[model samples]
Target: MSIAKRLASQTAIYGVSSIVGRVLNTLLVPLYTSRFVAAEYGIVTGLFAYVSFLNVLFTYGMETTYFRFANRPGTDRPELYNRVMTLLLLTSALFTAGLALLARPLMSLLALPPGHERYAVWIAFILGLDAVAAIPFARLRLENKARRFAVIRFANILMNVGLNLFFIVFCPDILSGKYLAGLRPLVEQLYDPSIGVGYVFLSNLAASAFTLVLLAPELLAVRFRLNLEPLRPLLRYAYPIMLMGLAGMVNETLDRILLPRWLPEGFYPGRSNLAAVGIYGACYKISILMNLVIQAFRYAAEPFFFAQSNEKNSPHTFALVLKWFTLCCAMLFVGVSINVELVARVFLQRPEYLEGLSVVPVLLLAQLFLGVYWNLSVWFKLTDKAYYGAYIGVAGAVLTIVLNFLLIPIIGYMGSALATLACYFMMAAICWWLGDRHFPVPYPVARLLIWLLVAVGVVAVSWWAPIGEGWGRYGFHALLTLGFVGLVAAVEGRRLKAL
Candidate 1:
């Protein structure tokens, strides 16, 4: 199959799971937003922001490390897999055990209500489970088991959604003296009506474990025997990546982490930061279209790029891949920008949460820069100059810290969005500029810029043209999308056809 077609197939399968999962999860945004006040959702948001950072800790950059060494010539695939799996198991166990030990103190530090300590424990467990499962998922990607990958991914999301509905939607009525008035005594004995957002975390913990059950084949494939001798080089390779991952995550999530500290009076007093976080997060989900695409491309491209290391004109091939990724991502940016009002409403069921709408475009562009940074980063990885990646990340992290510290206090959530955008753009530009000197790839920079300009023009026009009310906005967006499609065809139609 042609590369674009292969990528398209993988993207479709990946998108089926990712896009659908994001949509299903997005459904819960409205449920949570409508049911819980902004403060409650903010706490949910804040904790999960921490969860995103913790995931990087639990995985410890092994995902990319495994891909790097696994694709290196003359490496024994099974041995490499075993080594990485064993390492991950150790870390996962250690992390869970530590969390189990320190859950109370950490909960206190997060300023959880006294009765809400269990929420921290449940989140810790969910993350640990996900960490343990990371290797198996990465293995699926490396082996090109896209179908199995999609199935497991989609199934996990469905399980989470089902559990969430049972806990948040069905359980309250089922347990209360309303629907089951006859069994009120029995139901009251089993269900605690005041659990509130804590149940969300518990439901997630249960669903995470359930997701692991479906990975029985991968779990059973784990061998007792693990080689430590082959791990030295992998560790050397992964150390900088871990730093990069950690710093990168801090850049993305630290604003959420430190926002409470920066605010003299919290965004909403007497409420958990999770609620404000929820508003930010729910709106943030609207931008996941680009993130999901970037994630899918990374799944396919990383291993593929490493394997093609010795191929003729390999750098050129990488450049081409980067070009296409940029093109498609630019298209997504325009698509989302035009339809954002429709998309924003999906998660903002409460009119109050709609206050965060202005930050949506800012966050979307930030995520777009993040995807571009990811594509630009392949240069450092292929050349084994990963320390450069670390430098770039630290630069971004410094920006993240300085901006969030300064502006989040002044402008609130909008500051976080702006910080993220600035960080990612700086990282992408530095990586691209520095990478060209070491391992030059003739990316069609001019063509790529043209596409971006066209996307900007489309968004500008869409912003100004009302096209009237109700469904008219969607009609306007449709016309805007067609205009983009035609422009891409006119400018690069033959290039796409050649693929």
Candidate 2:
């Protein structure tokens, strides 16, 4: 099979896990918005923002590092996997222990409500288990076990979703009446209505633990030996990536983290900062379609890029991939932005959450730039200049922090959204300029710009056009989407046929 076809196939398999699973997971948004108030849901959002940050630390870039070393000609794949696993196991255990010990203090720092420190404990376990699972998951990717990988991933999401439904939906029935009176004790023990959003974290913890159990075969496949020789080189390559991952997460999540504390207090006299955060978080889910695609592409692209690193036409291939990726992202941006209101109405249970709908377009565009940056980053990874990746990430994080602090007080959560857009655009542009100096992929910049302009123009027209709120509006948006798709197909058809 052709390399492009192989990459597309792998992406489809990984998409089964990422895109499908995340879309299912998105179903929980309504449940969350319905069950909890903005402030309550904000707690879930804020804590998970921390989860994203700590996950980077826990895994410490070892997943990519494992791929880097494993693909080298002389490397012993199993031994390398064992070595990485051993290191991850030790670090995960140590980090979880330390976090558990400091749970109260950390929760206090995060300004959690009193008696809610247990969130820190549950999140600690979730992050640790996920961290340890990182190596095994990467091994599956490296070994080309995409089907097995998708199954395990799907199972974890299924388990999490099932438990969430049981606790949130059914347990309340048992508690409210005598329908399941015999199981009241068990239900009461397991479910605390006052704890509200805590069940989300608890469900995640259960799922992560279950995933570890499912991965037992891979866990036990390697002997328990901590070989320092291989680990030294691995760490050398990985440490920079760890730094980059940490900073990249800051760019990705720090806005949510900072929003609660930074919003002006007097704006909503009775409402807490989390109220604003909750609305923003709920609306942010509107961009999940874009993020889901980026994730699936990254999952497949990372390994594929590494495998193609030594090929003669690798640069040309990378350039082609970027052009097509940009085209797809542009189409997605138009589709989501034009139909933002429909998505908001369909997915969100509370009308109050719709206040932040205006931010969706900006966030979708931000994620598009983020996807482009990920594509451009292949240069640094391929050329062993991974430190350059760190440089770009840190620059973006600093930009994120500075912008959030400056903007949140003025424009509210919109400032945070704008900051994200600015950060990713700058990162993508910088990576492209720097990447040209080192790796020189012939990215189709003019064509990509034109595609982006067409997408933005079409969405703008749809947004401003005086259309009624019936089938006419829906049909208009549908036509716009189809027109964009048809144009892309017509333009790229000749190129694809040449391939």
- lDDT per residue as tens, model 2, 239-301: 899999999999988988899788888655556788888889898888878999999999899
What would the TM-scores of all predictions be? 0.92, 0.96
Please, what is the whole-model Cα lDDT of each candidate in the order they appear?
Answer: 0.79, 0.90
lDDT of 1 by residue, 65-172 (tens): 888877777988777777788888888888987877777786666566677777777888998899888888888888988889888888888887887787677777
Q: What CA RMSD would you report for each candidate?
A: 2.6, 1.7
Q: Report how far off residue 81 is in candidate 2 (Å).
A: 1.0
